[model samples]
Target: MTVEALLIWLIVGAVAGWLAGQIVKGHGFGLAGNIVVGIVGAFLAGWLLPGLGLGLSGIVGSIIYAALGAIILLLLIGLIKRA
Candidate 1:
């Protein structure tokens, strides 16, 4: 991917991660952790969303998708930890 694309992905990831942390409550993993969560969430969304017929266009949509995926990821992690 081009540097510009990579940069955009990182930005989107950061934003999504931060938002997810806020929504999930007590799940904020600082900056680097948040970035990781965001990136992974994006990948998860990339796979899961399309299968569900969810299509998001542009930056805002991407952020929303990533945040939703991150929230799901956090919830799953919480469940695993509790189990």
Candidate 2:
């Protein structure tokens, strides 16, 4: 990817991660972890939502998608922990 694209991705990743962190709450997976979760969350969102004709696009979209996916992931984690 181009330098600009890479930068954009990083910016998106950071924002998405922050949003995800907010939705998930507590746990607080640090900045790096947030980026990782955000990246993975982006893919997860793309996979789950788009199949239903509902994927977010662009930076803000990615952030929203990531937050939602993060919420799902956190809920799953919570359920697994309880069980």
Candidate 3:
């Protein structure tokens, strides 16, 4: 990917992760952690959501999709930790 695209992805991931952290209390990984969660969540969403026929257009939609995926990731982590 181009440097510009990569930068955009990082910014989007950071935003989505931070938002997910706020929505899912006690699951935040702070700055670096959140960035990782968001990037991984983006990859997860890119794989899972498309299979479900969920198509999001533009940057805003991408962030929303990433946030939803990150939220799911956090929920699963919470479950695993409790189990």
How far out, in Å, is residue 8 in model 2? 2.1
Tell me how far the alpha carbon of residue 54 in candidate 1 is from the true structure, in angstroms, after superposition.
Answer: 1.0
Ordered from best to worst TM-score, the candidate numbers read 1, 3, 2
TM-score, cand. 1 vs. native: 0.90
Those runs of model 2 whose alpha carbons end farther than 4 Å from true positions after fitting are none
lDDT of 1 by residue, 1-83 (tens): 99999999888889889988988875577888788889889888888889999999999999999988998898899899999
Cα RMSD for predicted model 3: 1.4
Question: Candidate 3 regions off by >4 Å?
Answer: none
lDDT-based ranking:
1, 3, 2
For model 1, the stretches where C-alpha displacement exceeds 4 angstroms are none
User: Which 10-residue window in model 2 sums to the lowest lDDT?
Assistant: 19-28
Cα distance off (Å), candidate 3, residue 34: 1.2
Model 2 agreement with the true structure over 1-83: per-residue lDDT tens digits = 89998777676666777776776675557778777777777667777887788865677776788767666766677799999
Candidate 1's error at 56, in angstroms? 0.7
- Give the local distance difference test score of model 2: 0.72
TM-score for model 2?
Answer: 0.76
Residue pairs in candidate 2 whose N, alpha carbon or C atoms collide under 3 angstroms: none
Decide which is better by lDDT, 1 or 2: 1
Each prediction's Cα lDDT score? 0.88, 0.72, 0.88
